[model samples]
Target: MTSSDPHAPHCHNVPGDKSAVQPDKKRLVSRLNRIEGQVRGIARMVDEDRYCVDILTQLGAIRAALDGVAMQLLENHANGCVAKAIGAGNGEDAIAELMDVVRKLKS
Candidate 1:
């Protein structure tokens, strides 16, 4: 049976090619590293009997940081991978995939 879900992953038989972000990859990695540290800090706070409000604030910051990362990734994917695929005459597939991603993001 075939699934109608557009967000479903499937094997496309295409060779995996590396796509790079327009911005510095090191900077992105650094941001992610900092987020990871924040997570660890939150864990330590929990263990150390920190206040609930402070923990909640840190969690909110983590969520915002994660959202920022997601936006950066989406922008990079659009400009690099989708654009390249469209330029190669596979825009329909790329657009469909992008739509699926957008739908999932909305959900």
Candidate 2:
């Protein structure tokens, strides 16, 4: 998905070429792995018949952690892809793509 927020500034302005933006794919993957572990821990808690409130708390934490990952990714996209596109005179498209992403996140 994409966005259409033309006036919304990104973290960094990059070229339109996505290949030019060097993303820390390894770091992202590692974070995701940790989140997976959290999920497994929650499952184990359930099997142990943990308190409902405790399980719910853990679930909330997991959601927050996932949101953190999403924010990081969004920052990277803004600094890399969105920035590049705007610099390359494709700002409209970039903004539209970002808006689409924001919409999905909100939903």
TM-score of each: 0.77, 0.74
What lDDT tens digits, residue by residue, belong to model 1 across residues 1-107?
A: 11232222222324575444344466678999999999999999999999999999999999999889777777666665666667677888988987888888766
Q: For each candidate in the order shown, give its overall lDDT on alpha carbons.
A: 0.72, 0.75
Q: Which residue ranges in model 2 land beyond 4 Å of their true spot?
A: 1-22
* Clash-forming residue pairs, model 1: none
- Tens digits of per-residue lDDT, candidate 2, 1-107, equal 22343322233443453342225666778989999999999999999999999999999999999999888777777766676677678889889988999999987
- Model 2, TM vs. native: 0.74
Superposition error at 19 for model 2 (Å): 6.7
Model 2: residue 47 alpha-carbon error in angstroms: 1.8
